[model samples]
Target: MTETTPFGIDLELDETVAEGHYSNLAIISHSTSEFIIDFAAVLPGVQKARVKSRIILTPEHAKRLLRSLQENIVRYESNVGKIVIPVPSSPGDTGPKMGQA
Candidate 1:
C-alpha cells in the first residue's frame, strides 16, 4: 500500500464547447482528502435537472478503483476479444482528425 499526501483539487472548465448562448456550468469541489466533480448540461425546451458527477476517494481507494475497472475490462475483452488501437496520423494525412476549415 502507498501512503497518500493531502492534496487539493481545482477545475478549469470552459463552457465554450456548449452550443449557442445556453451553456450549462458548474464548479469542482473537495474536502481535505477527497475530490468531487459535478457536471451539468441544459437541454432545449426541457427543465434542467441538476445532473451531477460526484467522485469521492482516498489514494488507496484509487488503486482499488483501477483494479475494479481492470477486472471489468478483462471480462469485456474476453467476450469481445482483442481490440484495435487507433493509429495516430501524421500531418498532411488528410483525415478527419484534422480541424475543420
Candidate 2:
C-alpha cells in the first residue's frame, strides 16, 4: 500500500462555476472500520450559509480536532470580537416579489 497522508481533500462544483475563487467544502463520515469524506458546495449566491463543512473522526481524532479548532477560535477572537451567528433574512425589509423585475 502507498504511504497515506494525514488528511485528504477533494472538490465538486457546478459546471458553470468559475475556476478562480472556488472554495472547497469537505464532509467526513465513518463506517464500522473505515471513514469517508465528501466535498461539495452550494450554488453561487444561493444560501451559502446553509452549506456546512462536516468533519468526522474517531473519538480520539475528534477530540484532537476540537482542541485545534478551539485554539484557532481563541486566536481569532483575540484579534476580532467574538464571532456571532447571523440571522437569516435581512431585517426591516420585505423580499422582492416574483415577476416584478
Candidate 3:
C-alpha cells in the first residue's frame, strides 16, 4: 500500500521516469478548463526542437504548482545563492540553445 503524506499521498517513481528528461525549454498552452505544458530541448543553431514530455493540469492544480515552485525557489536561493539569469546577446538569440521558434 502507498503511504500517505500530510499534503497528499505518496508517489511512486518508476525507474524510467526517475531518470527524468532534460528540458531546456517549455511551451505552455491553455484552454478554458486545463493547461498543457510541453517540455523540449533546443540545441544552439538547430532549427528544430523536439518535445520531450507533455503534462496536462487543471487550473487549480496549476496554480498550486506555481506556488510550490515559488516557495522552492526561495528556499533554493537562500541555501545556494541567487540564480543568475543570462541575457541574450542579440534580439533573436535564445541563449545557448535556439530551438524551434
Best by TM-score: 3
Best by lDDT: 3
lDDT of 2 by residue, 1-101 (tens): 23335575445455554343322445456677544544455454465433233335676676677699899999999999898854547575443221121
Q: Which stretches of candidate 2 lie over 4 Å from their true place?
A: 1-26, 32-37, 45-57, 90-101
The TM-score of candidate 2 is: 0.42
| Runs in model 3 lying further than 4 Å from the true structure | 1-8, 96-101
Between prediction 1 and prediction 3, the one with superior lDDT is 3
My TM-score estimates for the predictions, one after another, are: 0.38, 0.42, 0.83
Mind giving the per-residue lDDT tens digits that candidate 3 earns over 32-91?
999888888878779898999988999999899889989999999999999887788789
Question: How much lDDT does each candidate structure score?
Answer: 0.53, 0.53, 0.81
lDDT of model 1, residue 72: 87
